[model samples]
Target: MNKQPGTSGLIFNEPLLWDKSREGRCAVSLPKPDVERADLEKDLIGDAPELPQLSELDVVRHYTRLSQWNFGVDSGMYPLGSCTMKYNPKTNEVQAARQGFAGAHPFAGEEFSQGALKLMYNLEQYLAKLTGFDAVTLQPAAGAHGELAGMLMIHAYHAKMGKQRSKIIIPDTAHGTNPASASLCGYDSINIKSGDNGILEPLAVAAVMDEETAGIMVTNPNTLGLFESNIKEIADIVHSKGGLVYGDGANMNAIMGIVKPGEIGVDVLHFNLHKTFSTPHGGGGPGSGPVAVGKTLEPFLPVPRIVKELDSYKLVTDFSDTMGRLHTFYGHFGVMIRAYAYILSMGGKGLTDASKLAVLNANYVKESLKGTLNLPYDYPCMHECVFNDEFQKEYHITTMDMAKRLLDYGFHPPTVYFPLVVDSAFMVEPTETESKEDIDQFISAVKAIAKEAQENPEKLKKAPHKTKVTRLDEVAAARKPCLRG
Candidate 1:
């Protein structure tokens, strides 16, 4: 398998689609309208909207060349901590592209849609079993979308109890989307700082825990790549004040088989099917995040959950107080199809091994780079590891410099300056999919970078010499984005 796709010598100056337009060239030809030309002459035919006109070969070559310039999991290891950016199995894509599933329309009646509904129902049951939830909803399109639905249900639960809870307690180590979800539900987010151990303690939560709090949002294996050992105690404290506990399942890949959030006292949680289940990720893609809940909050899950009727499946909505529909129809059916295929192919043991290997690989890298880099936590990580620029700080080297230099090493850079707890953070997650050889190369590259930083600090300061472009002004790009030419 070639990591870098080769390009042909054929070149056309890389013109934009609009620039390729000619007098009347078109890749498609439409039959003349069935009605007379006079019918559309007055209004519809006044002027033709501007559209690119190109031959079929022209369009194909243009996109193919653009795709060659991009990198994906298939190209190499994408070790972005907390993202679970693992390799997507080609089998999933094959299963998703099957004509029956691909061509099926959502508006088709239940009788014509039995296969589709049954697949959704089966996937929901698999998720419920895995996460120990009473029920699940496949309505949310993505992870953050699932968060919104979960928070809305939490809001509805308290509203039904006649409690006007206005605040949601979130740990500082939780994902950035946690607070945004709470705020979307018209609740204020109260962020509490974690202790020195990078784990959120129950005592710290208890101080901020109050009757006005709607619930607490937490990531079990938090963004710092450390599991919150006091989660059960933290959940108890929140429950004592009659508040729910929402688990952000972004890190579920770390503890998929070893632990279940619902069994561990989480009232509600969501699953990033694309992340944990090995479906396609990123690119504003077709993603699914199914929200699961205990029986207490199950009534408020999005309406029209799938149910089995003897042998057939049906879409039914019957509950106490619902939050209504999050999507017009079942969300991202294609993504769900691919996810279901991944689960059946992997089975139970395979899934367990995936999580175990993820943890093992992360720990291996953490230990290997301990002295060369700066190990901030100095402990076993779940499915990812974190390091600061302590060793590089001596030579005035920064994490950004290290990240940029990784491109020259023939690897995508790990996430930088994140979790916002450690200074000059370098977060890396080598998912279970990578081979030992890939991991070794990553470690060697970092070790070389560390040596370079010590011996010649100037090389670290102005890095990424091998790439087509040198270091970019990210500050300028962020503060003053050029939207259009």
Candidate 2:
């Protein structure tokens, strides 16, 4: 299988569309005269825009080739850890793109867009039931936004009780956004070290809990791919200190139906619908992150929550002690619709089965590569596996070198040097949708890379030799970004 050249790879060889422009050639010829605007803002208009001039064929072929050069989950196995880039069902896309749902304006009258409102209302209810929470707010745009919303709710809860909790406890193995969100909410973030087994222990959490502790943000089945086995105990300690528990639900794909965060004493949680509920993640603007809160924290949830009253659905604008609106409208409605479709398609049993298969696939990869790689933690991983570069370092190869080499094998590299706790970390997540043959291909690729590292050290150093673009000077690229054509 040959790899497609990405945009970065095409920069050197591909001709710039602007460079192909001709003075008089145009894709379409326009009419000479049209209606003139009597009242227009002249200051806001530019004199002459430097527009590209190309034939229809040139314009069409350029983008078509570029599209073919891109890689996605549909094209191959995307083993991006913590991303859960599984195959998104086309049925969900079809449903979301339906005219009834997609074409409805956000400000349309409630009576005119009853179906969209109904879907949002029902999706909130379904998420609340799924996570065992009292209320759900589908206002945040993405996981990080959801974290901010959760932290704000925590702040509001503390303020309502006349408490001055000023610190948030986070595990060292958690996502980078955890501490950033806590800091954004004006709370001091306290870092707790993971136990020897790669899980957050209650003892470690207890040592950090105090009267000023705002809450603890933990990712179950943490970035290390191991479940926090002592989560219940950790929650107890925080709750005893009169603080709330915020579950970073980014890894919810591993235990969606198997475990509910609210049942384990979590007061608030956020769902990365783009990750766990099968929404297209990249290109940024369209992700949805809904927050679910238990009873104690429900009162402070973000306002403009959907409500069902007397068989009619409507958006509620006012609520006592609400945390206020995080977004302008009811969040990403199209993403929420896709998520609703995904939940309905999976149901309860299917969700549990998917989680089980995800765990099984991760464990299979871990066992297969145990001898070829260095496993930092000797435990069963849930949805992903973590390995370090200790084995490859013997051959003078680093994790970044190995990752770059994998790009030449027609596959996306696993996340490298993440979780910050492990040395030269390489995290791979073969999502549940991959077949055994695909997993075998990945394993074979890694083994072959290891062999190449031992046989020819220089080859790995100048890696991605077969790729259209070789390894870049990352530091230089960052310091001097060439933005203009």
Candidate 3:
């Protein structure tokens, strides 16, 4: 109805650095070596590698143009559904870049790096208090890593009781990583389907939970965007059968200060600092997933754990039942610093408000777009909502087509065909960061695309008409990747 944000405008056409390379071009003037050059042995030498030569201006303009084509949460609203791609505050970055935190060497003695140690010590306490767990280990590098640590601890718990369990219970509504994490720990995943209402039913969990099962891995405010209301009962069932409960805290963004997993009978849980704690999320390197556990599993946490004795902080590794090391250093220290900054900045009340606003924003989008999109579950959702192409199916327009078309509207697409249970699922999570106006624009774009599906179905088929790089052959790209050196 209105001029969409994705409408095409002036764009610069640029070429690769190699294509622009010339014989006499040089971006830098290197100084002559002061030391004498020594010849290496023939065995140690290799053929010279080909490299591009370009002017300083050429290199600067090339990268600057490339940056203009990129989009991020800072550039626009990122309703990336289950991912929680919310705005990461710049304050977190500032705190992380501080000299003491950033320059601390991992191999430095505890006495030399007391500031970093103190930060880690206090961060562990903050996380434990937030999640209502007895103790914590900031070793695991990511959510899946945290899950493995949790399962290993669960495995250790059962083994300590003189019997090693063989299986783990995972609900269909749980994160996709749950099964893989369980498998890595040598536990056969007993997958159970969620109830028709889109949440795990206590009866279904009771049927699969047994002494042979190590525990249950559940993603609360599950992938379908519905909360698992029967979690307490399910936890009770698992505990009664001599199994522990492993809560996948990926969706903790939706209930930060409101619900503590430990109080809900979860024995162990992990916090995704990137997802829930305002740390930069994508591009993969800087992620921190600190696992928190109850008294039963605390003894088996990862080694080199931070502790305080009298007036000083220390990293000790003498725990006999520990799960050994999970990272090269004490996890990603920069990510920990960012998360610690976020937690301290938000405090208790701010975190509660964030959860409340996240739920509110998601429901707002759900209610606004349900008329045009087919909502698989009509009930109240937590931090995200799942829609599908049922309404556009008659037009032969699919989820991928609509997602591509959203790019034309100047918005990053919400996750599509996920949570696996719903057919042609289009999951949307508008985190607490977006404004009402921005969300309305997103809703308008989706509704406009739905209208185009009926009026001009072919347009949706050849979608993303305005982007520099249009629709790609994603399947071929994944299967037959072209890696260039």
Which has the greatest lDDT?
Answer: 3
| Candidate 2 error regions (>4 Å) | 1-12, 29-48
User: Where is model 1 more than 4 Å wrong at Cα?
Assistant: 1-13, 19-43, 46-60, 483-485
Q: In model 2, how large is the Cα lDDT of residue 84?
A: 88
RMSD of each: 3.2, 2.9, 2.2
Model 1 agreement with the true structure over 404-451: per-residue lDDT tens digits: 888777788899989798888899999999988888888888888889
Report clash pairs, candidate 2: none
Q: What is the lDDT of candidate 2?
A: 0.87
Candidate lDDT (C-alpha), each? 0.87, 0.87, 0.90
Best by TM-score: 3
Clash counts per candidate, in order, are 0, 0, 3
lDDT score at residue 395, model 1, on the 0-100 scale: 91
Q: What is the lDDT of residue 201 in candidate 3?
A: 86
Candidate 2 structure, TM-score to reference: 0.94
In Å, residue 234's CA in model 3 sits off its true spot by 1.0
TM-score, cand. 3 vs. native: 0.95
- Tens digit of per-residue lDDT, candidate 2, span 58-92: 88887877776667888787898888888889999
User: Which of the two, 2 or 3, has more lDDT?
Assistant: 3
Candidate 3 per-residue lDDT, tens place, 370-454, comes to 9999998999999999999999999999999999999999999999889899999999999998888889999999999999999
State the number of backbone clashes in model 3: 3
